[model samples]
Target: MKASNGTTQDVGGRRKNSKREDESGRLGEYGQDSSVNGTKQIGATSADSSGENIIRTSVTWDGRSDAGKILEEVLLLKQQFLDYVKSHQGRLEARLDESKKQEQKFLANAEGLELRLRKALTIQQTKDESDNTEEPE
Candidate 1:
């Protein structure tokens, strides 16, 4: 690793005398690209290639004009989904309350009808008994 001043600089215990060569044998830094189709590959080396270790990394996209707009659109979509779920849950709760009220009303009406039927049956039975007693026996 020779510097332009014709001297070798000790950098991180590695002697760098010439221009740094990338994995593709192209001269560039970590994030720089020497061509349009090739990428600066940054991934697991041979030390951690198997399933024994976990490597954590994050990807940084090259700057584009519509990145913010795309992110905003995604957030808006998530909000819309949340809004729909909230409205639907409210309507469902209303329906549940209405159904409960209707069931209670139906039960009340049935109880009233049963009481009236019991009273009518008692009166009819008493009249029949009186008519039989007033007969010859």
Candidate 2:
């Protein structure tokens, strides 16, 4: 490889003079052009491309403003909060239904006991009347 100047530095750090030519015969930088195929090129890393959708949206919507970034974060947090609320609401509703069923069962049991007590009272009254009517020995 050669340096920016026309000096070709060898593998052993020995400098040799040579003609500098770019990949496309340009006399300056030895790489691809700033644009390719008549369109601007963007070299995004793996980490950058991972969130490319978010970055594009942010740039398009707000032109790289701080408030725009904050808005995106807030939206994500709001979605998480909504998801949590939905999950907790489902669990709460199930528990409430269970409690209602238990209360109904207790109420039905109380009503059944009340009916039995009334029946016992009627039987005792009939027995007392018969005993009073009987003659003494």
lDDT of 2 by residue, 2-53 (tens): 5757787755655586654455555556444467788866666563366647
Per-residue CA lDDT of model 1 for 1-137, tens digit only, reads 54757787765654667664576656436764345457545457674366543433223455655788879999999999999999999999999999999999999999999999999999999999999999994
Error of 1 at 10 (Å): 99
Give the range where candidate 2 is weakest over 10 consecutive residues by summed lDDT. 24-33
For candidate 1, the 10 contiguous residues with the lowest summed lDDT are 51-60
- How much lDDT does each candidate structure score? 0.79, 0.81
- For all candidates, the clash counts are 5, 0
Give per-residue lDDT, candidate 2, residue 18: 64
Candidate 1: pairs in clash? 1-16, 1-17, 1-18, 2-17, 2-18
RMSD to true structure for each model, in Å? 21.3, 18.8
TM-score for model 2?
0.48
TM-score for each predicted model, relative to the true structure: 0.50, 0.48
